[model samples]
Target: MISSTQVVTLARRPRGPLRAGDLAITDQALPPLRPGDVLVRNTWLSVDPSIRIRLAETTPDGYLPPFALGEPLAGLALGVVVDSRSPEFAVGQHVSHLCGFREHAVVRADGATLGGYGGLSVVDTLDHPPQWFLGPLGSSGLTAYAGVHAVLDVKHTDTVWVSAAAGAVGGLVAQLSRLRGATVVGSAGSPAKVEYLRERLGLDAAFDHRRSPLTDRLAETVPAGITAYFDSVGGDHLEAALDAMNPGGRVAVCGAIAAYDAETPPPGPRNLFQLVSKSITVQGYRAGSYNDLLPAMQREIGEHLAQGRMHYEETVFDGLESAPAALAAMLEGLTTGKTLVRLDENRS
Candidate 1:
């Protein structure tokens, strides 16, 4: 008999700050696997900006299902199959899914996908770790790649600006745009991140978003106005980007991290009329809506990773207990690049 540990919700409709008290760690008895069920030993769990949206009772446009109180929280997770009744997933394969934040999970086998994490496709792959799949090769990478290539339509001559430029998605967006021959500039919350973007990520130029008078900084840096804006931090950043956009520029609305945890919703852009005058195109994007483009994006990113054109870093915490702190760090702009939690590191 195997026991499972899971992170369960203790609150309903989170109104204010999410604390450690909102989650409960409990044990459960595992049920016998059915014909198409597989028992997964979760290795890494993704802590992304989207998870904060899941806590709300009302999701914008009903794209996300409401979270059930007392139920296990679910998001993108990478795991290994310790036992399986399904032939598609063998006993030692690494896989990922929208699985629970549990040490052990019994997933409906037919739903789990395969064939990522170093392309080794076996036990040897686990030696290298499968957590990377949740970042670069996983949904995060796809989101960044597609946002720049498909949605924003970046060109060689374009000047690209990425908000929240130190994040997993934003970092990749800047790298991809640079690889595509665009002059990329990024905005991060701190000077350290601004330095990482410039010196480490090789961004053409970078700025600290927290600096005084962003419009003045942007005007000084980009005298010609920004040709493309990959906006991850909305609100003031969005307004500044609008004010700096050249005629016929493009904006990819990837995320609004600046306002995600805000108690009061920020006002809409007062300069939205600039969109009309500048003939700018601003489009809100959801990665799920663009999954079909993942293959091409993956191909490009895989080649970039292989050739050293793109690089990523992650701040990983151990155990489910660290999930909340990791999330809070990410929201507070304390984490660099991607943030993840390793529950069963040895398993991976």
Candidate 2:
């Protein structure tokens, strides 16, 4: 059996923005597999904004604890089981897991859960590229599905505005909402992404959040006032949504990427009283909490994907060492769609 493997670890806590120097890739010895242990040779690693929250000295209460200094950092990953001590996982089976940031992981069959979703599960790679499970068909897809359908319960008559709409989950939420016949507006960080949202994704309106004031763009696009908002970027974005929301509007809160790297948490949107006046329903959730919806999500989203009604983009780094740089770029909004690291190039 292989002995040593390279794994990404927290060397130092980041201050403002994350730097590659704050993370370290170190060699570690793999322990022998016990009963129910599956040895996974990781191939793809997901780089998510939520991870930035845990990298801070403290995570939001009721969330996962922060990664200890020098501890191996983990996130969603895809891999093939190279060895197995349990019949539950056969050798050569593909699996989706949370024990990532390493070349290998010894995952338990009935292991700890990720958020609320089960941590380790077999994934069939027949109809799709395996890495897609780390993106649209897996957690990203699930998050979007939960936000757009479950939390927001978007209606066809609704004009929905999706913030960070060019991102992994946001992009999926935009398309899913559009497929449901909503008039969709999307906001991104760049002009090119805006074009993608307009021309490619065929959103009703698309704008660069960096170009002008957010309120002005919202007015320009949906002058009638959006009836629903899908928010991944919090802070000013949340406040702006509150300002632009129509009476009886609904908002889905899935992520807060805006102040993820800030030294101190940004204050809550000052306009929350708008909820009382406008009868707006602002609901925050993690996809894992809505795990029961996965089957429904997979069927609808998978059908849309197969029929060309949906689109997904990914930014993949070439090596395990690149994971840190990937995380840094994603936090700086320098990456489009889902950012990931390619660990095993030999995978078919």
Candidate 3:
């Protein structure tokens, strides 16, 4: 009998820091394999800004249901198959998706292929860390691709601005915009992150959001005004972007990390009127809403990763016991890109 450790939800409402009491780690015995199911030993657990939203109560029309207290806390993950009863996924297949936070999982054979979609092929590690599956080559990459290419419709003449530009999605957006021949600028909270963007990510320009007035720096950085804004921080960032957008500009709302842990999110864009006067378009998007676009996204991002056109960053915690600290660090902007927990040490 394989003993597995899993993170289970324990709170009905999470108002501030997600405490140890909010999640319980427990052991469970594996059940007998059922037909068409495959057993996977998880290696990585993704800790994302979206997980905070998933934990909160929302309207019935919400894209996903709120995580139930006392149930396994589910999120995106990367794993390897240890056993299989299905022909599709044999033993040792590497996989990544929205699996619960556990050392092992019994996923449907189709689940291994991501809802049985043939276009999404699971590749074995290619000299890259398994954690990349949760970042650049995975959901974060797709989010950046869809927002810049589809929603914003960036062109060679455009000037792009990305908030939280050193993050997984924002960094990818900065790279994609540069690829499209657009001038790219980004805003980061620290001097280190700003340096990472300018020196490492090769952004056209990067500003320290905490030290500089965003609107003034934006006006100086792009005298012609921003034609596309990949918004990840929201609040003041959103207002500043709105104030600097040129006519016919497009804003792709990817995430609002600045407001995720707040007891109350600051009011929405104060400069929304700019959208009307400048004839700008603002659209909110979720990567899960664009599964049909995954094939093309995967192919494009894969090519970039293979050719060194893009780079991925991650802050990894060593064990399930470090989950809370990992999540807290991510929220505090102590991480450069994706944040995840490594369960290899605790695997059965």
Candidate 4:
């Protein structure tokens, strides 16, 4: 059994974009397991935008509390139980936990819930690659599923637009919308990502948001107006989506990555009045709040994967030491698909 583990901690609150000293890697001795605890060797760590919200000292209402300085940062992870004192979990069992950004974790069996956002549960790697649990079959996939199906109510006849469509959740959202028979348009930061959405993911149309004004590009791509909007990048994208939304349209506000690290708050959608003019329904949600949909999401997404009807991409950063860099790259929109840190490359 391992006696020590390396962990990444929040050295300090980031002011804008994360800096070199913001995150620190430290070695710590593992604590003795309690009666209900299981020791896990973490293999994969998911790098997500939500972690940035938790890094701030004070967050807006409804946001999770900040990560304590000098304490290990938490996210999602896939691990194998190395030792266990709990009957519910046994040694060699694979599990998911919110103890990522670390090489090992001591998790309480009772405290862990199965297969949803922020919940811990035993996972079966036979169905898919273990890392898939961190992306497609995990929180990102669940968020896309719930946002599109439950929140937005996308229909076969609907026309959909997704911002950050090349990203983890947004990518899944775009594909799922298409599977639902919606005509999907997507926006990405680069030409390559736009091409990825168009050629690889088979989005109906995609544009590079950096090349032109979003409103103009959206107008050209979705001239008839969109029936549903899955928003990840806010600010200009939100304003553009609002401008191009059809009457009675629905919007799932998933993330505001554009303003996540901004020192000053970005302006709200300038077309706020359009919400009333067009009678649009805009709702913001966190994936964790919709854990009730996990079972259905798992069944559907799993089937899609098994049938080769769906595809996902990942940008991997090897080792726990690369986690902060991977996170920074994700926030900068430098990564495509799901960004992850692999602690044990030998596994998968």
Candidate 5:
């Protein structure tokens, strides 16, 4: 068993964009285990856009509290129990929890509250890599599943548009929508990502959002107006979606990466009246609110994986020290699929 571990903590609240000095890595001794405690050796950590909100000095009301300066930052992680003092968890068992940005974690056998996903649960990766729990088979997958299946209710005849189509959640949204028989259109930042959406994910059409005006590009691809829109990038993308939405269209607002680290509030869609004119329905949700759907989503995604109908990509950083860069890359749109920090390099 390890006697000490390294963890990443916020050195200071970021101003505007995050900087290297804003995060610090330090080592400390493990606390002595209590009667109900379990010690875990973390193997994988997830880097997500939501963490950017925590780096601020204060978050909006009803949002998660900002990360305290000089304390360890947290997110989703997969680990193995190395030592246990409780009967609920045993050594060698694999589990998923919210103790990431660290090499080791000590938590109670009853599990800990992690934002909205509920208590930690034993995760059996089966024959797949344990890191899969941090990406396509994990929270990211669940988020996309909820957006496509529950929020939008995409149908075979519907035409769907997804912004940030190459991203972890948005990529799955595109694929799942296509699987449901919808005509899917997507937008990404670059040519490579555009190709990935078209050739790899099999979207009906995709274009580089940077190559032309988003409205023009979306209009070109979806001339008939979209029946369902899965939005990951807000600002102009949302505005464009509003302009191209069919009457009675449904939109699932997933994330707004464009405003995540902006110093000033981004302007809201200029065509706000479109919602009134078209009777559009727009709903925003967090992945945590749909925990009840995980089992069904898991079974469906697993079948897609087995049949080669679904594919996922991940940009992995080597160690805990690389986590800050990984987060920055994800926020800057430099990553594809899921961005992950792999702590246990020897495992795969």
Candidate 6:
């Protein structure tokens, strides 16, 4: 039985980019597991941009509550069950749960889930690395899957633009659209990420959004007009997409990273009227609501991984101590692909 563990806690709310002083690694005592509780030894922690939203004083409606000062941060994590009081889970089983930012977590097998995600569940690593479960095969994959198939309804004939295309979710969306024979245009913050989209991911066209006005970049990359868009960055990017969208275009709004770090929400796109004029469709969705599509998402992405038909990338920070820095870097677009924290490198 675990007695104590170190966890990352919110030391204070940050008005801008996160700094180490805003967070602290504190030790806490764990109580004896109750019946139906599963204790896990966490191996990998996911560092996502969405967490930035929660660091603010308030979150958007229907989203998770903000993290209070001195409370541990929760996120998607992969761990092996070390002790179990529940018949449903066995010791040594690998499970994914929301009790991350700590070396060990005590999960209630039947407890409430975080927006239908981060519930205690078993997972098989199969031939892939255990960490991959936290990346392409896990939440990131599910998000990309839902936005493309369930929301955007991308078709082969449609041209699609994926913002933040070099990141985890965007990269998958781009490749998935391409697999259906759609022409895919991607935008990233850096020339290197643009090169990655074109040379590594084989995107139809790619551009650095930071290099010029997004409207011009869109014209240069997708002059024919895109029929579909998978949006992560919301501000000017959404405005640009709206301007470049063809009549009857579809937009799957997953996140607003452009405003995640802002002290207050930025202004909405000034061109939203284009939706009415052009008969366009814009929908916002979260992965939790689309749980029914999980199996198909995992199977298809798994096959793509096995066949080498898809490419995935990650920026891993070593140790739990580095998580704060990792989050800051990811928020600044300083890291590429899926940002993650690797705990216990000697173990896995």
- Model 4: lDDT equals 0.87
lDDT of 4 by residue, 1-348 (tens): 678889999988898998657899999788998898889899989999878877887766766677899989888899998899998888888899888889989877777442335655898766688898889888999899999889998899999999899999999999999999999998888989999999889999999999768889988888898888998878988888888888999889988887878766688987899999999888998787788888788889888878977778999999888888998888888999999998873632
Candidate 5 lDDT by residue in tens digits, 28-102:
688999998889888999998888888887776777788898888988898898898988898899988888899
Off by over 4 Å in 3: 17-21, 29-32, 57-60, 110-121, 124-128, 345-348
Tens-digit lDDT track for model 1 on 1-348?
365556645455555656656666666667788897888888888888877766766556644665777767777787788888877788778777777477788888556332221111222233234666778777788788779878988889999999988998999999989988999999998989999999889999999988858888798878888999998888988899999999999999977876666566678789999989999999997776766776687667777877777778898988886776777677777899889988855542
lDDT of 2 at 165: 88
Per-residue lDDT of 148-245 in model 2, one digit per residue for the tens?
88888887998999999888899999999998899999999989999999988889999999866788889988899899999998998898899999
Per-residue lDDT value at 327 in model 6: 84
Local distance difference test, per candidate?
0.78, 0.89, 0.77, 0.87, 0.86, 0.89
Q: How far is candidate 5 from the true structure (C-alpha RMSD, Å)?
A: 1.9
For candidate 3, write residues 130-182 as lDDT tens digits.
67767776778778888988899889999999998888788899989988999
Structure candidate 5, residue pairs in collision: none
**Deviating ranges (above 4 Å) for candidate 4:** 112-116, 345-348
| Clash count for each candidate, listed in order shown | 0, 0, 0, 0, 0, 0
Q: By how many angstroms RMSD does model 2 differ from the true structure?
A: 1.5
User: TM-score of the candidate numbered 5?
Assistant: 0.95
TM-scores of all models?
0.89, 0.97, 0.87, 0.94, 0.95, 0.97
Instruction: Output the worst ten-in-a-row residue range by lDDT, candidate 3.
Output: 112-121
**Candidates 1 and 3, the one with greater lDDT:** 1
Between candidates 2 and 3, the lDDT winner: 2
